[model samples]
Target: MTIQSAFAGIMEAIRPLYDAREASNIAHLVMEHVTGLGKLDRIIHKDGDLPPAQEALYQQALQSLLELRPVQHITGKSWFYGMELTVSEQVLIPRPETEELVEWILLDHPTQPAWRLLDIGTGSGCIPIALKKQWPAADIWAMDVSTSALAVATRNAGIQHTPVRFVHQDVLSPDASKVLPSLNIIVSNPPYIRESERTGMQQQVQAFEPGIALFVPDNDPLLFYRRIAALAKEKLEPGGKLYFEINEALGQEVVALLVKEGFEDVRLKQDMFGKDRMVRCTKKEAAPADTTSPS
Candidate 1:
């Protein structure tokens, strides 16, 4: 089949599964991956015939797309903060909003020579890896509860040549604090989506993504946030920063929780889409104990 025909066919086949724009985008990704052609080259060779091997690969990718598989899963990688990281069903696909959270951190500490940082629920190691790439002197650690997810994250961190310490522990566990160290910064994009919202998510996300990385109990939607904040309270250096990519709908709730936990300078920031998707705060220095004896 000609390049033009193949691309058009893939789009048409998946139109029912995705809208026009998304279908076209996925078709373009498949075409680029299979043909090893850039968008401009694809356009220039629109009518050129696909090689037999390319045709076979295109057909197989089209089938997966038709099944509502995420394009990144088919491509086996995703771009986050200008870095392409390997991804799998084992880890949640890094999202652009999370990149914004990283950007916020960079903006706040643009030129720190040395700092210790931790990322809780570090699926694919995107946040810590990206930060370490930017701040090489920073000591970075990432933890995840899922062993398979940690394996994927380890591979991505290796590919990026970012030396991030990976820990296998659930942040919700009481023992989790025992393994972590006091740090200058703590960040997390924890499970903030309520289980009740699952029905409204895309079929590809609901079906192919790891539920452990994406959801929280409906009755306790802030489960991860509460636990991670408490841990940060105990582990963050005085005046150290805490950051989170939160549920847009729960921005106020998360801000309140952080304040109640004694975090100061709490701020909720919006993503590109103007959704309240990120929050940052500072840990207050401890008060000196009463030195004067009572009469």
Candidate 2:
């Protein structure tokens, strides 16, 4: 069958399950993954024929799409901060808002020699890998509680040739300090979504994505933030920065929490859609004491 005919057939098959626009997107994503043909290229090669093997592959991809599986899972890859990273059900798919957090960090701090960074709950190692790629001289460390997730992250780090120290440790545990030293920057896109909120999420997310990496108990929505912030205060050097990809619904509460924790100049920034999606703040510098008090 011609490439165009196969593409049309796949889209039509999934049309009942998704809106027209979403069906088109899924069709394009599947085609790109299976045939190495982008949307425009597919149109350009509409009349070109597909071999039987390629056609079979396309059909399988379409079947997955019809089940509403995420395109990244189907392709086994995801693009984040200009790098293609491997992904699986074990790790949370990197989101664009997290890229905003990375941008805020890079913009606030000038790259310097010997700068050390810590990424808590480093799902796919997106933030640390992006930082290492952008500032090769900076020292990077990533920690995660899930060994399966760490395996995927480590593989992506190697593929990207971005050197990072990956440690399998639970950040929520009380003795996190034992795992690493103080850092110049601490960043996380920790689990902030409450369990009750899960009902409102898409099927692709609620059904397929790992729950531990995406949720916090409704009663303690700020659990990870509190633990991470306390650890940052102890481990971060004076004047070091903290960054987070936050839930917009709890922006005010999160900002207040950080400020009360002695973070100075705490600020919430909006994403492309004008939602409060990122936060940045610095550890307060110590005040110098008077030296000539004795007479």
Candidate 3:
């Protein structure tokens, strides 16, 4: 069958699950992966015929896509921060908004003197991997509770050759604080979604992605944030910063928690969509004491 016909078949099969535009994009990506051709080449050679073997692969992908499986899992590759990284069901697919968070970190701290960064709940290690790309000389570590997720993250770091330390530890564990080094910047994109909200989430995410990486109990949505913040208080040096990719509706609440935790200079920032999706705060440096004394 012609390449053009294969794309049409795949698009038609998945049309119920995705819109026209997204279906077309997914078809192109699947074609690229199976044919070893880029998107432009797939477009330019739209009329080209596919061999029986390649057509079989495309058919398999079409079947999966129709079931709402993410294209990244089928392709075994995802593009993040301009770098191709490996992904699987073991990790949550990296989102563009998290890239915005990484950009904010780079923009705010363009240059630093030997700073260390730790990313909690680091599924796929996308945040710290991208940060390490920007600051290759800085110390970077990322941890995830799942062994499978950590394996995927470790492979990504190896492929990028970024030298990030991948730890297998849960942020919620009692001894989590003892495992971390003193950090100059502690960043996290933790699980903030309430379990009750799962019904409202996209079918693709709910069915294919790791649920542990995406949700928390409704009664305690800020569980990860509170735990991580407590650890940051002990692990962050004076003037060190804590950054989070926060839920839009809970920005003020997160800021309040930070304030009650004695964090200073707390600020909420919005993403391109104008949602209060990013927040940051600093551990205040101690004020110098008076040296002069009465005679």
Candidate 4:
């Protein structure tokens, strides 16, 4: 079939599953991936016929779209902070908010002559890889509890040519000390979504994404935050920073936790929607030892 005819057919097939705009987006993404054509080029070459094999691939993509599978997964890749990373069911799809977390870190440490960064729960290595790309001189390490997720993350690291140390250890485990050390910065987009909130999420996310990477116990919504904060206290150098992509609803409580931990310059930053989405806390500078004897 001709390119125009194939595009129209695919859009019609997926229209029932998504709104017109979203369906159009899916069609464009699939077409671009299959044909490597920019939007203008695609329009200019609208009369060109798609090969039979390419037409079949388009049909398969439309079918997956109808099933509510995310286009990123269907495409097997995603762009984050100007780098493309491979994605799979084993990893949580990188979100734009997480990119903000990376941007904040880069802004905080604009020139790290020899920086060390730790990314807890580095699913897909999105945060760490993005940081490494932006600050090529930084020493980056990432940890995850899931082996499968680490595998995907490792592959993406190689693809992006961003070297990141990937450790296979659960940050929440009692024996985490052996695997962690003092670092210049600690950042995590940990699992903060309460289980009770799952019902409200879209079917695609609830059905496809890894649950362990996406959820927290309802009774302790700040479970990961508390553990990571405590670890940062032990491992982060004085004046180091901790960044998190937090739930907007928990912004106040998160700030309270950070303040209680003796973190200074704790601030909540909003995402593009103006909802509180990220929290950045810097450790207080160490006080000088007393020189004079107490009376």
Tell me, by TM-score, which candidate is best: 3
- Separately for all candidates shown, the number of backbone clashes (residues 3 or more apart, or on different chains) is 0, 0, 0, 0
lDDT of 4 by residue, 227-276 (tens): 99999888889999899999888999999999998899999999988999
lDDT of 3 by residue, 163-194 (tens): 99888889889888777789999999999888
Candidate 1 accuracy as lDDT: 0.92
Q: After superposition, how far is residue 163 of candidate 1 from its true place, in Å?
A: 0.8
TM per prediction: 0.94, 0.94, 0.96, 0.95
The parts of candidate 2 lying over 4 Å away from their true place are 16-22, 38-41
**C-alpha lDDT score of every prediction, in listed order:** 0.92, 0.89, 0.90, 0.88
lDDT of 2 by residue, 1-295 (tens): 8878887987789878788997887777788887887888989988998878888888788778777788899999999999999999999999988888888888876644469899999999999999999889988999999999999999999999999999999998888869788798999999999999999999999888999999999899999999999999999999998998888899988999999999998999999889999888899987788888789
- Model 4 CA deviation exceeding 4 Å by range: none
- How far residue 22's Cα lies from its native spot in candidate 4, in Å, is 2.8
For 63-90, candidate 1 gives per-residue lDDT tens digits of: 8887888999988989999999999999
Query: Would you give me the overall lDDT of model 4?
Result: 0.88
TM-score of 3: 0.96
| 106: Cα error in model 3, Å | 0.3
Which candidate gets the maximum lDDT versus the true structure?
Answer: 1
